[model samples]
Target: MDWITHEEDVWFEFRGNSPHQLVPGRFYRGTVDGYADFGVFVDLAPNVTGLLHRSELDKRLESLTWEPGDDVFVQVKNVRDNGNIDLGWSIRQGENEFRGARIHDPDGEADNQPVESDKSEQTATIKTKPVSGKRRHVGEKSEPKSAAAETQSVETEVVEAEPETEETTADDESRAPTASDVVGNLEEETEEAEAESEQETEEAEAESEQETEEAEAEEAELPERVSLGIIGDHVGDHVTVEGTISSVRQTGGPTVFELRDESGVVDCAAFVEAGVRAYPEVNVDDNVRIVGEVERRRGELQIETEDLTVLEGEESEAVEQRLADALSDEARPDAIAPLADHEPVAAVGASLLDAAEAIRRAVLESRPIVVRHTATADGYVAGAAIERAVLPLIREEHPRDDAEYHYFTRRPLDEAVYGMDAATNDVTRMLEDRDRHDEKLPLVLFLGAGSTTESLDGLGLLGVYGAERVVLDAAPADEEVAGETDVLVNPAREGADARDLSVGALAATLSVAVNADVRDDVSHLPAVTYWENCPQQYLDLAADHGFDADRVRELREAVALEAYYQSYQDKRELIADLLFDADEGLAGHVSEQFRIKVEDEVETAEANLEARDVHGVTAVVLDSDAFSHRFDFPPTALLVDELHRRNRDGDRFVTVAFGTDELYLRATGDLDFRTLVESAAAKAPAAGLGAAGIREGRIEFLTGAREEALDAVLAAVAEQF
Candidate 1:
């Protein structure tokens, strides 16, 4: 055997093998070969030995005796060169104890001693030779065989001494030298020794045979293969194991159930009729076992049955009953009472309650509020009153001086009350009042003629205050007074009023806006309503302008279209003319570059066809004023160069549009052109031929009069071509 050593650790390898046969950090089962005061010697593996220190033995086990040939399981703690090895043997705390009998002695007792034979002495001497060098301590008990042998020798001496004593004492000296006396003494001693040896041999042989039988039995019991199964297989079919259920669901007629077990978990299902009846009691972690048929559902094995048994007993049953009662109560028509009456003052008071709640949520979530109000007496009074209620709530929620609130009122007090005149005492007084009152300064609500109009105005305030609107329906009252109130909160028929107010709906709306800001209960509100109610145009614009040039172009077109439509619908003519002029100019320039004459009468058709030739060039503009004309200017050339560079470097497709006096270009690539444009423009001037202007103009290049005049020359050549 070849051995390898790493410091105190050693491992042995067979000859011609690359890997060591025995390694450290592993436990092995072996037999005790010998023991000394220092430690017990163990045969760790075939041809390998290790030491189990006396100190390492469990204190309780140490008191019991041990001998050679005793089997033990030990961990290889360390190994050393020069054939030294260290081993440990002790059951770890919390581990299961051994099940076999606890034997304290290796040799049979005196009463059960076997008869001795002459050959046994030689064998005994051979086995004991290796252990003779180390002596047992004075207090230690003698070996079991030694004590038994001493008793037998003493008995033999007593029997032989009686015969010798019977002979004459005077002739004893003469008889000691005689052949008969010496031969007789030697023969008796030899017979006694042979008897003891024979007894020891028989006992050793019996022990060896028993060990061999045990080994054979253990080998027979070792399993050849192992398999795993769910606990339901062993337990009753309708059994339930309960814990928190994750990802619970139902499909079609069957309600699926997944129960987790110690090893893992199993999937089960119940029919619709079964599921509904079970639903009253079948909650997550109810500790119920349902008996069902084991079958496959959607390619996965699941248990299906109608029988249910609650394992948690009384507690789970009571919970199920209470849940059923609550649900039934909620389903009744008269579950909630109707409102009493509608009063303007009371409605305002109720609105203040809602406003207070909104403020509390906003403060907790660290979000701003966008309020819209009318400048009419009712608007002022309501707006002022809401501010009064909300500001104190916010201050109470957040006392930090660093806390911020922004106001985007319908119009500044100066603009609304004093107009352009700065000398008015009333305006000055109001300004002083607003400055002095922290609540008045942060009033973000706007005043308008109607609630719908007010909501619209409030939309603009959203961008300024980073807030969302929480609308409260106004109370139904006399038309004169009702029209002027902030919120129409009617107390007459509280049930219908609550339905109209929809606390859940409002919470959802505010949740969508402030979810990312709030940390607590407010964050738990569902976001479905926010997405559903978001303006389609803004959402569409955001989607199209997804931080890219294509998106930017789409956004620019949307913005320009909206502005043009809102400002002047008749500008369609201007748009068309601009597009046509830009197309003509671009055709001339490209024709001049390619040395091909573009046809005059057919220029529009030719430009469209040519644009289609370039990959990714989806839309082409013929109107110069269509926001694509600015690209033709020299200052905007850099943007075209950058775009052209990106197109060459990437697999993106490009689009060309011609504005009336300018050319517009856009490309789609992996890199974000919007961020690039923003970055480059940051170093340049705000406007007037800066990077941003160039970028905008490149996508909307403008053509000079000279270039427009050249269109005729190109047209003449295009006619010939």
Candidate 2:
């Protein structure tokens, strides 16, 4: 392209076709074709437009004063294989500023030839290159010239190249061609050339799009597979992992699958639709392989599943066997040692091993433990011992501080039975936690409770939801209830006297088995359970640690008073302090209050006691409805325990404290509530007397037959005597 000075304006002349006229690194005169968000598009040649991107601009696009169709000077930055032009802003605005005003002529036989000009005498020749790889000179001698001389030479070439049609039309004088007519002809050619360029660009884009799709398909075929243990290192990396589904939970956005392999467990989330099941056939404990990208959400590592497939037959069996082997090797304790030297505690040796294994598995599998115990001093001691032992293990196993509180809970039961009321509360709360927080279903444990037939319904409800159950009690556990629980630790099941072994003793033994580090802290708990007739073995163990009878009693009283204050809460820290920590005045102060409260209630019950001889047995019947503080501290059950302890002589004695709807009996003689309820029901056929809670020595009778029930139960006690 060559440029000529026409008056004050500069005009461009193309010596070849439009495509070859604009060469890379050459200056060209162009028009401001249009404005766009990115930059300004300039028409450099007839059909060619180049982008002057915002980055390449010397000044702000908004500050540019050029309008559409206004001429501007630009340099060709690049010419792509697809014929796209990249333009750069040039500060040189006039044609004279360019060296020699060189023009590329593709059609010239001699690339550049001298054309003597009539404009200026101080002339310089132009040296040019042809598109066919030939170089020629415009004059005999070619050299660099001043800007004015270059302007003069460029004007000479333009005049000599003027078409013959312009000269002929000028001589006709009838209708001569004007300079405006020549300009109009060039504009028509430019419009046609632009249409051709646009068509070529569209075809090139279509080919690029096809190539991109093929590349993505190839990438999908080759995904990296990794193990669960190493998945954390590959966060944000797409990988595949194979394992068995340990659990499944559906949330608002995705279905979370707990994928457990030999190495570890990771959650794989699949989103098919909001709250919709991703793989309907997949269930808990099924073997499957998941392909997903590892990601961290809310500070926990998760896999965003892109594909999931269920394994069957040999593959599924292999996965399950691998996981079973890993669990057996890693989670199970190598050996079991009895926590006590007593025969009753040692009799259930296999059950203790099973119990420890269950607790260990719950910790390893990340299942929360729900411990329910009776709300008595002994029960609190037992529950607190397990809590003390398990919480430290939970903290050691998990990194979170609140994991102990969140994953392990010890709830106090009013009585030693998993009654329907307690079960309902547990079910409601666990279900709410599961649904609202995506928590795993907890392993329900009953210590000092849920070992009798009375708790069968409660255990069965949890069983219906596939939850695991563990029962550890110092009571005569029913065979049916024992069959329902995964682990049953009961001395009675091994033909030992359950009455001699307090629940606190049994639960503390289990606690020591769960975590050996807390054994010293919980050694005195068994002695705290017995108010009188403390076991010689446990007393000796406590005495070895300076916890004499008085100290043991103080611990019991402190726990009992604290238990009564918050009857529902476990009061974990307070109970732990009283039992595990040093005897630091807390027990002494609280024990004095417990003694005063119990003595006051006992003195009042003694004044109202009605003693009578029924069938040669002394029956000290106290109307708990009239004398006892029916709604206040020192509950009827505890009061009867104290009354029986204070008033029992060398004769057969039975204390029957009947309330509004229930009966509380604590006997010094050989009168088991289980036998009394059976014998009393035979005497009073209408009273439906039954053992309501064997551990608490409670019996149930129809309120309508209260008088008959009392008489029949008294007669039964006399028969036992």
Evaluated with TM-score, which candidate comes out highest?
2
Candidate with top lDDT is: 2
Candidate 2 C-alpha lDDT tens digits along 1-721 = 3433321132233355455456566666788765544677787655667788768888877667676677888877887776667888788776566444443455776444422235566787766433331223345355679998777566553422555697687777778778999999888766656665576588789888888888678557747768787888998898888887766767534677878788777878786654567897887667898888887653578888888989999888888788778778766566656556888888887888788878877776668899998899988998888888788776655434466898899899998889888888888888887666546688887888998888999898888776789998887788999678888988888898767888889888888888888888888889999988877889988888789888988999989888887799988888877887785688999999998988888889999998877877777888898998888889888888888888876577777899766788876766666777899999999988888888788888888998899899888888887
lDDT tens readout by residue for model 1, 325-387: 543432222211112122322334444344344444444332344444322222332333333
Model 2 whole-model lDDT (C-alpha atoms): 0.78
Clashes of each: 67, 1
- C-alpha-based local distance difference test score of model 1: 0.36
lDDT of each: 0.36, 0.78
Clashing pairs in 2: 114-138
